[model samples]
Target: MSKKNPKTLTVERAPDQTSEQATAEVAVNPAMNAAFVVDTYQSNILGDDVDTDALVATLRASMDKSAAGDLSGLESMLIGQATALQTIFVSLAKRAHHQQYQRHLEAFLGLALKAQAQSRATIQAVIDLKFPRQATFVKQANIAHGPQQVNNGHANGGDTVRALENQTEQIEVLEGATHGGKEMDTRATAEAARGNPAVEALATGHRPKKRGR
Candidate 1:
């Protein structure tokens, strides 16, 4: 039987070859993807005027590093970091806080995010989590919620709950244990509450208006 050494599995690049050239060739330039990010990111995330050169450089460097890596994990790590740096630049650019200070903030954010892929991933995750959902969007779109959780998840209960959440106009729940008599809610409630045609003038949010010029 032969014993395998773990070190043998690790891949190392040749020291003589240039990393930047290899990276540029292997990885799609990050700046190309950044354009998509700029378009897709929150409307409030970026200012009209941005330091294009700096952002481009950061993206290029990130992609270059990513393409140069021998492993896919390294690629993801680089992409993640690039995205994070873009976010920072975009956010700072949105602010336009000072005379010449705008450039400094953008630079700082770019540098800070570029240095740490893990940090960028964390921040990006938080931002993703915080993004607002449309009222109709199901809360279960978040994968972190759990597999059993449905996107359009509803509260668990019987017919009574189904009525309330769905606005069924009529639903009933038994009040007592075991022998509890079924309560009739569909009785004289409507006429008593509205008084026939006396209160027909009130308008609900969606009620259509009668025509009268």
Candidate 2:
């Protein structure tokens, strides 16, 4: 029997082909193609002329929006977690009741209590997420350190006019009283002088001599 030498098959590659290109060319399956596709996309994104800051900002914005969406849906997730914790608590409670030893019973009960507390906390978290507490912004009031005089505007000078009128009326009344007293004194002197000369002389500021009775 003659032993035949096995022929080694040589593969031809392009002069410009890289190791990655060779690997991509050899890959036939979609999974292998997917990896290379991702690599090609990343390479395209990280090109020399690419605006790195803009790219990073865009990626950050996308991620931030996704995170915000997750937060928006967090209420349902927290409620589910609370429900699951309640189920665990119930299971633990049943196990605690069936335990024969005091230590096992205490251990299971403690675990059940912990689960119950966690469930309560999850529920509260959901409530807090859904109905967030309102922020109270207190406005700064500029208060004077000492006494401040506040002037509410005057009422159209009505008070000033009333005060002036009151002063005028007081002056007129004083003048009238003086004149009326002078007139009364003059009338009294005229009537007394008509009846007696001596009384008239005394009223006129002259000295009167005593006359024979």
Candidate 3:
């Protein structure tokens, strides 16, 4: 009977090569290290006898199919899942009805509700996949132009400009009414002032000229 030593399995480093150089060589190719890790992982899943190249090719094909937007298989799978959930929901509801304890009934009923919700979600997923919601993209233009003013009350091609001018004039009249003349000239300065002497003199400020009845 021969006894095996673990030290015999270890490879002795060359006398000329330093540890730092050996470590640098080992870490030289990151891509090769990643490939090595992937190989080991796939070997664990598919066994050492499986061809990793063929498996990788198949995975690439599946990815290409998805990238090409061929989703018939995915849609079928979702529909099948929805059907399965519906069956589960019915089964749970029946079980809930047959339960003697109130707590058990409630528990089963809650599970049935969850299954029902999952079924609805699956169906909605299919609907969304088939007839996708149309996305409205509002394009904003950063144009160097005049200022924009929005008049929600007025319709297009109406008297919007005219109405605005009228409003401005009315505002000016209202302001003038609210605040009386800045300066009143009742001095009868020139020919025009002398002609309307009575009109220029305010009744409040100047008493009516003594009229000999």
Candidate 4:
């Protein structure tokens, strides 16, 4: 039998086609696109209607029997409940103790700050009341002692004033003497420049030579 010519299937791609086109296509389904959901189940362990008093009595009886070595069937359950209750009470006690400690710490810090502020205010008040009085006393003492100590002398007021006047007159005399000496020197220099024989003789202690006829 003659084999039929193999059929060739040709796919036409655009010039911009790339190797990424060879990747497999992904299928999207509505079910896969749905959001995640969780279902929670809850049930009451003891019963739908619980009688707390009866439960306590039952647990007490079981504990009594277990203590007496009677091995009641509910002894393990009562022990488990008691352990859970003890853990919860211990946690509550720790929280209460921590809260009390925090309150005490905050109270102590507040008292310390208040005491510091009060002490600073008291010190400032004392300084303000005393400093000006001390300064005024010092200034008065200086003024009271100034006149008696002026000349280091025990003389009376009249003698002290006369002594100060004499010292002032001596200072003025020395200043005048210095000025007179400077004026005399300047006059001598001028006379020398004018060729005065008397000034030259006075300066050298010798007579000038007579000019030739």
Candidate 5:
């Protein structure tokens, strides 16, 4: 007998299963079918995208069908819609939270700015009060110790000097008070920017640190 060629003896085995046969054998469950239907409906509603009224009507119909016990398919459909709605609601909640935080931050900054403005006004008022008093004192001093009075060494010259000295001392005290007020204002602004408890106290014209101790 002639020896058979090894290459000729090789035969290609047929695939265990064709793609069409595999697909035919696979079964789609009711839940999967319901999910697909829900997805398709949502896609169509989104594509329309013109009015929320249509979406609402569709949702109401689904809900009504779910409420009626006549259809068993409604259960899976309701579950799929509920899951999608949950995701949407969660996203809305996150956006709302972010917006709320932004509003709060803006309100806080507004309050801080208001407090700083009030503090600055108070400091300005203090300076205004001091400058006018100093100007008056200087005018009185110059009038009391005019050239004639200096040349003659007027009897009241001692009293005039003492009065001017007292006035100077008063002006210095007012300056120190204004400086302290300014320092307090700066501290309050910094604390307010940091969202500290000191902000409330500062806004209310009270010192939080002193109260805390």
Candidate 6:
């Protein structure tokens, strides 16, 4: 017989495909296991036509046994919590954007108040760098004390009036600044231009010849 051609030979073979997958079992605590009824596989929640009293009694008895010795059985309190948690409504926590939430807080006011309170520590940072000693602050008034009451009790007129007038002038100058200060003198350029060389010479009448330097 002639040798069979390898390409012409036919054979039946099973089709290639992956097998069906199964989920692996995860071990959970016994307390959680109490949520499932062993025989019916129904969830033991509040709406069920029920066994709460039995579950509670079972929990109490189990906890009493486990708490002292068994250590693996469901505790009464934890069972109640886990069961109760099934019906609980959990609200999502809202996250405030970092800087926006504190936009209206008085942090700057707090800082300024702290600065005022700790005025002694408000010495210049430059001063701190150079001297090892802590600063002892001395306050100087921008406003001098009003005239002392003598036995005569009169403010000296000349000094007081001069100060008042000076203050009024300063206030007026400040007010003027808001409207824009007075324009600069443009007179010098005009004066120089108008007094041409001929006019200047005429005004001098004639120039004397200079003597030897």
Highest TM-score: give the candidate number: 3
- TM for candidate 1 is 0.19
What tens-digit string does per-residue lDDT give for candidate 1 at 48-71?
344444455566676676578534
lDDT of 1: 0.51
Please write out the lDDT profile of model 5 over residues 1-213, one tens digit for every residue: 995442221222348977656454333433334443555576656553323333334555665665784443444544455455445545544455555577765655555555445545555544553454543423232343323222234567787567767776777776665554653343443434455555443554543556565
Q: TM-score for all predictions?
A: 0.19, 0.37, 0.45, 0.21, 0.18, 0.17
C-alpha lDDT of candidate 6 relative to the true structure: 0.42
Residue pairs whose backbone atoms clash in candidate 3: none
Residues 87-171 of candidate 2: C-alpha lDDT, one tens digit per residue: 9999999999999999999999999999999999999998888788999976444332234222335455676456556766777
Model 6 residue pairs with clashes: none
**All candidates in order of lDDT, best leading:** 3, 2, 1, 5, 4, 6
Q: Model 1: which ten-residue window has the lowest total lDDT?
A: 142-151
lDDT string, candidate 6, 1-213, tens digits: 995442231222335522221111111334324533431354344344445335545655776786687544433434444434322312101112222446433444344444443433333332343454877976433443344222222357576557767777777766554324565454535454454665542344466767998
For model 5, state the Cα shift of residue 156 in Å: 99
Global lDDT scores for all candidate models: 0.51, 0.65, 0.69, 0.45, 0.49, 0.42
Count residue pairs with overlapping backbones in model 4: 0
Sort by TM-score, top down from the best:
3, 2, 4, 1, 5, 6
Q: How accurate is candidate 5 locally (lDDT)?
A: 0.49
Mark the regions of model 2 whose C-alpha exceeds 4 Å error after superposition: 1-65, 68-72, 140-145, 148-213
For model 4, residues 107-194, the per-residue Cα lDDT tens digits are: 5555555544554555554455344354442222112222333433344768867766776777777666555465334344343545
Question: Which ranges in model 3 have alpha carbons more than 4 Å from their true place?
Answer: 1-60, 137-148, 151-199, 202-213
